[model samples]
Target: MKIPIAIVGCGGMGGRHLLGLKELASSDMNNITLSAVCDLRRDNAEHLADDAEELLGSRPLVFDDMKRMAEAMPDLQAVDITTDARAHHLVASTALDLGLHVLCEKPLALTIRGCNRILTAQKRSGKYLSVAENYRRDPMSRLTKALLDAGSIGRPELFMDISASSGNQIIITPWRHKKNMGGMLLDGGVHNADMMLYYLGDIDQVYARIALWEKTRYRPEGDGAVSGFYQRWFGEMPESIEATAEDTLTAVVNFNNGTMGQWTQSYAAHGRGFGHKVIYGSAGSLRPGGTRNGAPPVLAHDGQDEITGSPLLDLVPDFHLDAITSNLFGADRLASYDIPFPAADRKLLAIELYELAACVLNGTSPEVDGFVGRRAEALCYAAFESSVLNRPVSLDEIESEQVGSYEAEINEELKL
Candidate 1:
């Protein structure tokens, strides 16, 4: 029997998760089904249903309200949440209390208070909750992790993650640029921070600084005067927009393992080659993609010549919907394409579904659990704190609170 899954939020990322689930459903590794979907917009929910039906030969129930949907569908085994960061805690807390396994999107939540709330809910309910910190699942990043674990990069002393994109020009959506919805650091760098924790272990403290370069711009919707990156990207030029949220953040983090590292996440930079992570160790250093200026990305004990070549780009998997091919028809072609396939999130989503189905049928814990998710969330907050205070902030300094009552209330709402 297929483990029934529900989804909340049917936007770009949510749609990608649905597509990935469709591919997983076709595979024999697991029997899974998208039984229900919810979005703030009814049309978006229906669109997801229609897409699932066309792609997977099954149509899921669509609803505008996730709470109402969960109430009506008690049989749902799990819920995949891809809403904005602000709603992550609310939706995930609700789902977990209802005894539904939750696979939530990253950052977990914008504030530590909210994260604690979700954590409390998980503890009280004992329901599975996992954050979709997908960058760790990226083939290149995973390979880097393998090298680090294998001691190929023996005892990493310094780690640098420089992630800059061409800006969110493609993302005309208003929520992404909003500070309350989690802005860039929370929205984008959370994955990088999670990946760091995955490789380097827990962070003890962090110190950081942040900046927003572009001040003003015309709104994409032609509205007047917005703030921060949204204003720069959408409002008028030369108008100084107050960046209540950090757009450029650089931080030094102290890990419990005694390893020290620096991370820089910036949206102000305009460049083509931006995303890269390099680890310097006692033995060898591995950098994703090859090095700049024709240098090798990975440097080893024996020097650069000893560096092994990267995994063939063609062999990388595509777990998301590409512009040209469907996952069903593109299976064989995945080997032919030279480009690195699927964004990191899609790959993680696929792996997550596989594990989720197994856990449901066999009754085991997920590979990544609520504790792991919380740890990742902590690192991100530490970075934010460090950046804000301009000094290292210890994890112990941060208070830990539970959301058991909050989740219980939500569960009652669901009649769970």
Candidate 2:
């Protein structure tokens, strides 16, 4: 029996997920029936419903509210939430209360407490909760982990994850610039935090200086081209907007395993923007590629030839994509791929959807469960707390609620 599922919040991310569902339906691992698409905006719901009809060969029921959808379709077993960062807890907890398993987009929630609210609700309802972290699911990420475990780079000692964008353009949407809505940092930084955790083990403490370098961001005038995947989901924009979210961060991350790394990112950078995620070890260093799009991992070993491309695959002979991922992406053991952005993105989303179905059918836990999501989110908060207090903050302090001065306002606003 196919699990009956729905995609909620029919905005940009929701549109991407619809594309992903289409990809999943075409794959052998397709298991969930997209029973509905819900959104507060009726037009958005109807727009995706029309797309679902054309793409999936059947129109899903459209709803302006999720509760009404649940009441209308009692068999609805799962919901994939693509709402804004702030709405995750409300929507996810509601879905869990409706007895539906959930697959929520990353960060899990705006605040750790918000994440816990959804988690506590999941615990009470005994439903599976998955965090849609596509980065770690990338084949390159898997291979990188395999190589690290195989000691291709020897003992991990230092990691440098740096990203800088030079501009004051509105990032994605307007709400992303608002602190109440989780701003640009937590909105995108969760992926970084998750990647850091994926590469290095648990983070111990964070010391940082975070700043809102861009007080105002201008919306692209006329039809100015935007960046990357966001262009696909661009919509109407305001001419100018006041930005509340901090746009710059430079932090030192101390890992539990004694591995230390620098995490620096700035959208307000003025000079040539640069970005890279490289880990240097005793023997060599590795430059990881971007997620989903099958970029090859780069490795340089001491007194040995630099290895990359297909040859990098030799380092981890036992490394291979899971059965589902292998079939979906059509490469089980390749080190690099040429699949384009949104296409590759859809495949990763299909993998996430397929995993959700497996958990529902096989009674299993999701690889990126609620707790895993919380840990990633807490690291971002730890940085924020550290920045506010002007001192190093432990992940334990942030997780245990001992140091949440940074997120107190967000938590209070949400009533979490």
Lowest lDDT block of 10, candidate 2: 223-232
Give the per-residue lDDT digits (tens) of candidate 2, residues 313-372: 777888889988899878799788889887888889899989999999999889999999
Residue pairs of candidate 2 with colliding backbone atoms = none
| Tens digit of per-residue lDDT, candidate 1, span 106-126 | 777656667777888988888
Candidate 2 lDDT (Cα, whole model)? 0.88
| Each prediction's whole-model lDDT (CA) | 0.64, 0.88
TM-score of each: 0.79, 0.97
Model 2 scores a TM of: 0.97
- Candidate 1 regions off by >4 Å? 165-172, 217-244, 271-273, 289-299, 310-340, 343-345, 399-416
